[model samples]
Target: MTDDVRNIVLGVIAAGVSATLGWFTRSYLWRRRLRRKQAFFGLPENSECLLVVNRDPGTDGAVHRHDVFALLELSSIVKDCSAHVQILSHDVGRQGYGEHAEFCVGGPGSNRRTAAHLATLLPGVRINTDPEPGEDRAAFQLGSDRYRLETGVAEYVLLARLTGSQDSRPVFLFCGQRAIANQAATRYLARNHEKLARRHRTHSFVLLLKVVNSQAYGPDVVEVIGDVTRTAQTPPPAPDPETD
Candidate 1:
């Protein structure tokens, strides 16, 4: 080959080798950074948790309220452990009303801890829905109040009965929809009923509420119950004697 041709071939080969090395170096650094971050967060090297939130299906715009509950649940699970966690929220209907609202009302600080912990484990959390704004405050207020008055208190009483035993786990509260008209009743139900049950010193029950439509609500609630029950089966960490 002529001198010029040889020079051109050498340059091309050099460029290809340089590109390959750069790519490998970048991949290694990226992985190392990820490992360091995970270590700092104290996340388990390879386990995962699933977090879900329910959302209103009616609206076309804005972050749906259901996400609030999902985030809270995610936060709670991750508090002080390291595990890969996946957060999911179930979306049902246009009204944008469902179980998540109930979940959001209580335990704000504890919820945040769950979310922070999960963030360390998962790549990222997300909601599954298309955005749409629905009904005005008046409608939500009316519905919320009525639901509360009608079943809110009664529901809580039942929950308390179920959870008040010594066998009870920590009850994570969840709701299917906001009972605007029945706010007092609902709040009373959630607090009083659950509280009374807890006093029994039986089982610990963590109540999780997800807002859902009338037709499908029962099944959805059952599903959440199943998950909580399963989680409860996992032996809790030994209590710190110092704290006790």
Candidate 2:
């Protein structure tokens, strides 16, 4: 081949090779991200997932506004992984935990499904649904530490990924002291799922999150209090004999 022709052909071949490598790299990265999300969420690609809803008490078929936002955020996540979202209200919801990936939202005060999860899965955690006068209602008691609610100033919520002993699917729990806190938890999950996946890939965990300035930020301002996985999952210590 002529010198100029050979040079042109070699340059074209190099460009083709570079393009092929770039496409492969992009494909690999996309697949990796998808896998990590699937693991974090316990929902395989193109699977049927359940969204257990918690309706507000004393309301006739009405969902809290913040809870609705929370569900919408979670729905985007489910959509990202190509999973179908089938919603069931806490009143009539009946299904096995491990059969499909599930996301349960709202606190026990309104969500009996969440109450059941705390009862069966998280034995150490206790939520005060009702309190007499001069006491803080909707407080959380995990072991000895008590998280009190203060309206818009401060609120606490729980986000947990729980898997049954014999089941591989994980059920995500979003229990909050208030409706806004529940939305905050879901926002945190949506933003930090990749980081969470890296640390606890497919493993169960529980987190305590604080919502700050909800009156101003509307679930946008949040901070992590700590990981309550160990304390929440473990049963509380028996009453001390000395105290008794």
Candidate 3:
């Protein structure tokens, strides 16, 4: 073979090797990310997850449009992990709670299951279901810290993750003051799961998420107010023996 011909052949082989390596590298990184997400969510591949759908309280058992959007976001996350999502209503049977990987949405006023979880799992977290005239509908009171609704400007939600004894999988609670806030909380979860995993791995946690500019952004703008794990789980202040 001529010298030029041999050089040309070698160049083609080198290009093929480079392309193959690139493909393998991308595949490896994608798998690694998938594994991390699965671990963080306590969901294995092909696992089953329960989606408890919340309905509008005064309506004819119909879900709010914003709440439906929230569920769609959650469904995409589950599908990404190759998991199956089984949707159930907020009024599921007792066998539900902690029996499987779950995502329970809405506030105590709307979802009875969410109310039960707040009463049982995070006992200290208090939400006012009934309000006097001119009072906020769902005011969250944890010790001295109070979160009230401000309509379009700002809204609050408590996003929590906990594993139950009945099932090894985690239950994500998306408790919000309003339907738009629920969508915002789920959006934040989808965007920040990786960061959240790094912060708390396989451990239960609760965060206060604030939705800013909901009218303009439509749940796209969210910020983590703070971590309320301890306060939500227990009273903020208890008299120590020494103090007592």
Best by TM-score: 2
For model 3, residues 1-244, the per-residue Cα lDDT tens digits are 9999999999999999999999999999999999999988767899888899999976899999999999999999999999998898988635645556889999999998899889888988989888454465688898678888888878999999987663477889999988999999998899999999998987899999989978888888888899999888885465667753
In lDDT terms, which candidate is top? 2
TM-scores for the candidates: 0.28, 0.93, 0.91
Predicted structure 1: clash tally: 75
Instruction: Mark the 10 consecutive residues where model 1 has the least summed lDDT.
Output: 137-146
For residue 124, model 1's alpha carbon misses the true position, in angstroms, by 30
lDDT of 2 by residue, 38-60 (tens): 86787788898889899887588
- lDDT (0-100) at residue 92 of candidate 1? 23
- Candidate 1's residue-wise lDDT over 131-162, tens digit each? 23332211111111221212322221111112
RMSD in Å for model 2: 2.1
TM-score of 2: 0.93
Residue 62 in model 2: shift from native, Å? 0.5
The Cα error of candidate 3 at residue 166, in Å, is 12
Model 1 misplaced regions, further than 4 Å: 50-244
